[model samples]
Target chain A: MEIELNDSKHTRNSWMERFETYLPEVVYGSIDGIVTTFAVVAGAAGAELQINIILILGMANLFADGLSMSIGSYLSNKSERDNYQKHLHIEEWEIENMPDDERKEIEMIYRQKGFEGKELEMVVNRITSNKKVWLDTMMKDELGLSEQKKSPLKAGLSTLVAFITAGAIPLAAYILAYAGKYQIDPFILSSLVTVFAFILIGYIKTYVTQIGLLRSILETLLLGAAAAMAAYFLGDYLEKLLV
Target chain B: MEIELNDSKHTRNSWMERFETYLPEVVYGSIDGIVTTFAVVAGAAGAELQINIILILGMANLFADGLSMSIGSYLSNKSERDNYQKHLHIEEWEIENMPDDERKEIEMIYRQKGFEGKELEMVVNRITSNKKVWLDTMMKDELGLSEQKKSPLKAGLSTLVAFITAGAIPLAAYILAYAGKYQIDPFILSSLVTVFAFILIGYIKTYVTQIGLLRSILETLLLGAAAAMAAYFLGDYLEKLLV
Candidate 1:
């Protein structure tokens, strides 16, 4: 797709624009959802488990694990933000209390960046003269932190929604088969459904990251297939061991 | 742990120092490894698959999926690095061919940071006077990209090693049980092993990121448990549906 860099002013902000920052959470959640859920369905099929058992386990996993992932994402993001803020405050205080030392730090940072002599002094003076600029520079250069003000709640919600949405694909086949919609083995149907889901997620990932389209799609598809294959074979072997 | 910022001079470069950048890849690989492998085992058990099948599927997932994930990580990182380099080269060309425009961009960037009047002009001139500085400023300020010079091969290797290490935990019980060492249900043994592994990984994650230890450990454990529970129940449901 054509991504116009300066289109923000010309075009109305779409949903993707509004929630662009949360795209990572969504992609991470969806990939996890598809891989884990499909592994469950594939393993059960390999073991020849009863249909009710598969549905029970799948549905339980879908919501429970999805929620768990979202909460984890939220907590991780919150903690990171808190850590950044804590450091930012510390930097601000240091700049206030030790202006000379902070100025030296700015000099050191610029010097390391290859500045020297009159130029380095000018750069340092220009930056330290402004409190905000000095603080931001210290936060970034010294502490290696970014101003990622992502909302934890929004991240959690995005993860949950994406997790459940992508996760339901594998189980959909079974649900349909149970409803007598298809004659084929539910495992086969689930594979087809999941492959499609993988490709769709891959495309979305490409859109968000603006990476290579074919490679991203293939990478995701291969990842899902690899997971399912491994689960299936392992389940089959375990069945033989018990017997 | 006490992390001394200037300790790089006092301390000799350690293995960790050499490979610190690959920590994220390791964490990502480990988490994916444990969750996916355990899901396979849990689903197979719920389906009433034999111990042999669980081992087979779990091992397959451990190796196959782990490798897949590592390769994916490698390729993605490589592509990202390439993209950054491509942009860096373009920025260099722009700075050389169209110096005026590039200098203005530098001014605009600093201006957005609230610099104005003499300070803004000085900042712009200071940066543009040096080719290297100008390019670096344009890359970071205008493009919002940082120099992430992480080796893709090291990232892949770290991911593969961590994946196998963490992924092996869930399968340990089945391997022991198959050897007739344990009389308890392998699932129960596996759960205990995995919970410990989860906590350990959580602690590692906490160490790497310097987040809350208790919260991180609890989060990882809960995530693993939730995924297992879901896979178990889904397998159970599917079995019944088929019958």
Candidate 2:
């Protein structure tokens, strides 16, 4: 038999939908990047370390960490997708081998939801008649699984790109300072830049999660500040002990 | 009327249940602590700064950041609880004043669930008879919210304790070195210590989240290493530019 191809036109609107799918990963990756990288800079500054050493360590951390995060994201997503497929297969097998048992499960599920008598039987009959519908219902109601179907590669790529882009923010001040154009302490500038990055990330997070914008921004700022404060004081105390 | 002393004997079993509830916060706090503090140590070492300076900054960071994290956790949790309570009040008000409309919503909700005829009417009747049950069904089915009565104070306390306890692991070597007891480079020792901490945290995370132990451990290791590497290199690069 000849196969009929059912293709739909891809448009800018579709691409935007895909972008929305990746938004969570982007937001999380960016937040992780800026916070961790800035913590490094703050630590170095607290130690009164030379600018050169800070640059080496910070740069190493930025690229290396960003790549590693992306790889980890890729693996995690891949594994989740694998697990989902495995379950899907198992569900399909059950439906094929034990039709009666599977149909009863649907009946019981509806019965528990207050369905009874003719209505309950009808729901079971209607759902079990369609293989696809039966499978979907079993997957959701019985196994509590939902199909996400996000591409692992795209997830990883988004994380990597967002990481590098956001991770560079704090370091920008230091880089500029080292270029002989700015006379101020690079650490001071780094702090200012990082705070701004934190606020921006928090603002973006609000858009994605629909949290109150001001609350999100303040929360991010507080969290970053807390991390830096702990690092700084700890370093100071240890220095005193050595002295 | 005599008041019933609705009291049960307090037992260790109840406390264990409470402990289980705080497990997620502990895991996250510990992870945050070790990673952020270690980032500081790595940054300081990269800059070739005085060991004393590193210790000072690191210790300062440990305490300050831990407290800050705890406070932030408290506020975030409180806000969530407040929002939930506010919505709950609104739901209660609607149910009281708009009983007819609300009952229709309940009926529609069940009908959509495939309940029909006698079963659909029973489901609606049973639900509408009890105010508390009706409120709960509306909250969950219509509002899509479930009550999560996790205490804000407990969450904050858990985060603070975990932050200090786990965060201290990486700094143990530095503290020992500062005491003039360890001859080896403290940074090297700290790296080893922090890696162990990362693995330990990952292992605990598995127990909490039911993720594969090996995968979790590896992910944690890579993430921590990536952060340190980026911090170290960036610090180095900036140093050269300044020179």
How accurate locally is residue B9 in candidate 1, as Cα lDDT from 0 to 100? Answer: 37
Give the per-residue lDDT digits (tens) of candidate 1, residues B129-236.
Answer: 778778877766567667766888888899999989989988999989999998999998888888888888898887666778997888787777777777777666
Q: In terms of docking quality, how is candidate 1 classified?
A: acceptable
Clashes of 2: 62
Off by over 4 Å in 2: A1-12, A37-50, A53-108, A138-144, A185-188, A191-195, A228-243, B1-24, B35-50, B60-160, B184-188, B191-199, B208-212, B222-243
lDDT of 2 by residue, A1-243 (tens): 111111122335877878888987898788767765676677667666566555665566567657766766676677677667777888789989998898988887666555678767866776677677677667655665556468989999999999889988888887787677799888888898888888888898775655689988987888778767665555444444555
Classify candidate 2 by CAPRI docking class. acceptable
Give, for candidate 1 chain A, the lowest lDDT window spanning 10 residues.
A1-10
Each candidate's interface RMSD: 4.5, 6.8
Each prediction's total of clashing residue pairs, residues at least 3 apart in sequence or on different chains, is 48, 62
lDDT of 1 by residue, A125-149 (tens): 7788777778877776676566666
Best-fitting candidate, scored by lDDT: 1
lDDT of each: 0.75, 0.72
